[model samples]
Target: MDVGDLLGGNAWSYVGGTLLVLWALVWLYRDGLQVDAVADKYVLVTGCDSGFGNLLCKNLDVRGFHVLAACLTEKGADDLRMAAGPRLKTVLLDVSSRDSVQKALEWTTKEVGEAGLWGVVNNAGRSLPMGPSEWMKVEDFHSTLDVNMNGVIAVTMSFLPLIKKARGRIVNVASVLGRVAANGGGYCISKFAVEAFSDCLRRDIHYFGINVSIIEPGFFKTAVTSLEPLEKELQRLWEQLSPEVQASYGDKYLDKYIKVQRLIMNAICDTDISKVTGCMEHALTAAHPRARYSPGWDAKLLWIPLSYMPSCVVDMGLKLVLPRPSKSV
Candidate 1:
């Protein structure tokens, strides 16, 4: 066939048009369908003190779902209660602490009762003491892992029975960093653990009619991404380093490290957090929720794609973007 004939809409055009139509239909069917009886369902969201968790709690309350908002502080709980509808209940939870998670679980059990918990959104996490892995101490790693990784595991285990009873959804908040490992410190490591845990949990629990979904959002403006606390934390790490170690890295390395982070965060951080919470909501309410959701343009266009690239390419790109250590050969 002549090229002009194909351009003029021949069998090739028909095939292309048909494929586009089929893609659209599949997209609509996947996103448009939602589960019924949301009013009777209960969804428990952690880290409701602020950010995506807070917004999701408000949105879910407005949608008529019984939203159990878990805040780490009394002020956060009070603030959430004031903003959300009366159907929204608040629980004080510190997911990193075993005792706190247990108490919250008991409270959640009583609140949910026989209907059980319809959804568990593990939105709590920490992202600090982030720099060169060598600059960090074991405690620094644990401090972030305690909240971001162990916290997710503890919360999921505590609520697994309840979720099984309801045969409902488990939505765990990971990050695009989980797939890409584009940063140092425990933040990416913890998220990588979340990705693995979510996958294993999904396979193990699917037989019980439960669905586990992972939310891998790119950077957003939240407490997790705040620069103030990070500045203080990184400074402390630098100061505590032994004299030889400090000399090896040079006095100005810390400045460059923080500056690089600031530049990246400023360039990529999305202020519209609803982009993430909307994916979480869909994971909760969709009749056939996706196993994973990457909820930002950066995640779709950059980080996730980088994760699939050849290791040598990713390493070379990182070497160009990331600062070299003063002690490097």
Candidate 2:
């Protein structure tokens, strides 16, 4: 045989063999191929007005899951109900509101029943990335903490009995920022607390055959980042600063901050959100779910590595991206 012909045929054979192996693997895991198994399982998801909550609710409903989508506003509830069929229910639930949570629980138990409850996804979270800590107010930090951390806790506690009885899973939508610190002001801190809380919950509930999973998504084309309010907030933040701080940082710093923020927003918009949703589905229905799911390229490539890196190294790396206070003359 000619040398050229032998090399070409062998290379083609390798490619063909690799494709066949991949096809076989896909066939084996066909059931696990992001197909929702939420059928007849009543799941209560908080923050369903938009973002992951809404998306998950719609996706699950389409896949035959009985989803109880809890929204904060009437409009959100209406949107969810319209988008999803009768199998998907919409209720007004504010994780920060004790009364709302109590009412929602009663409604779910009375209507959806305890036997059908399979999972609870605490996907409702707010991120206020105020660039610099100094610029962030105490109230801003506390408010974010209340909604993100305290909110998750309240929902979990309220629904713990149902989850335990059903041996269901708890999916907490934490951020890669939680696992690895970021330049974000209060968001990272809140996520860190969430991570700790979820870990403890997992341990406590394991004996009861309940699983707790945390999703650390890098970014996605969600309303949280791409909305006009975020850009308006950044502009407002810059405007509200003291003259001394404003003068010191000037337009350059503000511009850089906005640019960086936009870059992140665009990246999130560019990536497929299914990567995050796929993890959410796995966390909910997988027989052997992972304790933590890091979704997206940024989460896998950057956040995970930095999370394991030495503290000093991580700090040095962060300093380059983050803004620092100006030096005195």
lDDT at 106, model 1: 96
lDDT of 2 by residue, 83-144 (tens): 88988888898888889889998998886664746889999888864566667667768878
The runs of at least 3 residues in candidate 1 whose Cα sits more than 4 Å from the true structure, single-residue gaps closed, are: 1-20
Tens digits of per-residue lDDT, candidate 1, 157-217, equal 9999999999999999999999988877899999999999999999998999999999999
Q: What is the lDDT of candidate 1?
A: 0.94
Question: Judged by lDDT, which candidate is best?
Answer: 1
Instruction: Report model 2's TM-score to 2 decimal places.
Output: 0.84
Clashes of each: 0, 1
